[model samples]
Target: MSNSYFQSDLLSEFDRLHQQVASLFGGFPYSVRSDRYGAFPQLNVGSTDDTVEIVAFVPGVQADQLNVSIDKGVLTISGERAPAFGKDEGDESRRYRQERFTGAFRRIIELPAAADPDKVSARYVNGCLTISVGKAEASKPRAITVQ
Candidate 1:
């Protein structure tokens, strides 16, 4: 049976507000990923039996600016979250407590042994990037029927 109290409107409202604050502040922990030189958008890495999944949250970034590829079991996502409001013309120099991320960034993660980079697919929607790497045919589990 479903718990009626779990569907309270107040809880839903609170969850909405919590998400709003997190997005406005560039997600959680506010840490940028970098291999050596340059940072990349925040990402979460995981996998399933059929495919490996990766979700990257990169706001204010253009799809063209992003680069996604899987080579040698390593998945890489590189892109630049251009400064909002179009900071063009190089008007001298001014600085404040700018927590917002700018410039280019990249995040790389190693996939599981069963992941097949050749069969990977990616999609970008509403500033969120999702990549799925299909599992190798040999690695898939086969169902056995009892006689």
Candidate 2:
């Protein structure tokens, strides 16, 4: 076979293997970035000159139900959402449809090297959890004057 043809065949095989692996884990919605399809508490991450900001949309979770922490440059957000229809909903067979997510969930975010773990702050307001991690002093931008 020509070199070009052999390379194309190898690439196609690799692509097929990737698809098979993805299919095996298709049932799981969790991913490292926490942005996978159907992942709970969608997150938006951005960085400013002095801080890294993260916002998680959790419409039904309360402030007390959420927990945020940073360890070894990894930020972890975990919490539980109670069922909407109360603990006792007559019989399980009576329920026809349920779309809401109700249960414990944990999402881990890897922080940049410049993020200062000691300067992290988190707040939950209006169904949104906002987390701010201050950048290290050396990482902040500074204007240098020419001599």
Residues 1-147, model 1: lDDT tens digits: 988877789887887887676556542232223222223566776767788787888888888999997777777788777665444655545766677888877676767778887898888899899888889999998898999
Q: What is the total number of backbone clashes in candidate 2?
A: 0
TM-score of each: 0.66, 0.73
Q: What TM-score does candidate 1 get on C-alpha atoms?
A: 0.66
- Quote the RMSD, in angstroms, for model 2: 7.5
Off by over 4 Å in 2: 1-34, 86-93
Q: On a 0 to 100 scale, what is the lDDT of residue 103 in model 2?
A: 94
Q: Write the per-residue lDDT of candidate 2 for residues 9-55, one digit (tens) a residue.
A: 78779878877776676554342343444557789999999999999
lDDT of each: 0.72, 0.82
How close is each model in CA RMSD to the real structure? 10.0, 7.5
Which residue window of length 10 is worst by lDDT in model 1?
29-38
| Each model's total of backbone clashes | 4, 0
